[model samples]
Target: MDEEVIARYLARRDAIDQSVDLVVLMGSAVLESVEVAAEAHRTYAAPILISGGIGHSTHYLEGAVRRRDCRSRWIGRSRTSFAIC
Candidate 1:
């Protein structure tokens, strides 16, 4: 793994303004999305918008989110309110 890239990615919020409206999570980022989005909801109190299909991690993500006490609700336009996609 690229430590530099991971460091920069993890530290990305430091450069962004704290005032955010919403967060969108997509693609094959199962656990990462859960972690980030859950943290964002806890920290920012913003709603999460997760979008994606059944990638390899889909079932794992669903199970992970549920295990974390996070719930996934179906939203409009084929989107979801929680971080499982």
Candidate 2:
């Protein structure tokens, strides 16, 4: 996971409130990225929308698998508001 990217995203999200009703994140790493984003969104009170489809080949497959794994881990956690797709 890229902490820098996550931190930047969090900082940006923190700059707004209610202004954003939903946030959509793409990419296989979305699961982890969303987790970090969700934490930041908690402070601003925003809902999240996670999106990722099966990959085209092996590389994509790997990403999808990792994302799925992360998603499973996030399943039972309670937070401000979020969703996985």
Candidate 3:
């Protein structure tokens, strides 16, 4: 990765608020992304709005739920809501 890109990414990441009213988890292929969002929700007691369709990350999402041993039950289609265990 370029130094400039890394710097910009770190800067934006460091600017995030410690707590928020909501956590919008756009779909990602990485389990760590989901874990982070889940942690945010737990820490903030905020509702997570799961945007984006499953797309190509179906297996990744399922694997994450299993690996984390979370009974993730999605409610609704298109934009959904779920809570991690």
Q: Which candidate is the best by TM-score?
A: 3
- Cα deviation of 42, candidate 1, in Å: 1.0
RMSD of 3: 5.4
Candidate 3: Cα lDDT at 26:
76
Each prediction's TM-score against the native?
Answer: 0.47, 0.39, 0.51
* lDDT measured at residue 18 in model 1 versus the true structure, 0 to 100: 66
Minimum summed lDDT over a 10-residue window in model 2 is located at: 76-85
User: Can you write out model 1's per-residue Cα lDDT over 1-85, one digit (the tens) per residue?
Assistant: 9999997886475545567798776655346656777787777788878667766776775676667665644333242335343
Q: Judge candidate 3 at residue 43 and give its lDDT.
A: 79
- Per-residue lDDT tens digits for candidate 3, residues 1-85, read 6999985774354445666889887776455667787878887899988776656776777677667765545444232344445
Q: Which ten residues in a row have the lowest lDDT in candidate 3?
A: 72-81
Between candidates 2 and 3, name the one with more favorable lDDT.
3
RMSD of each: 5.9, 8.3, 5.4
**Model 2: per-residue lDDT, tens digit, 17-46?**
246566666544335665666775676566
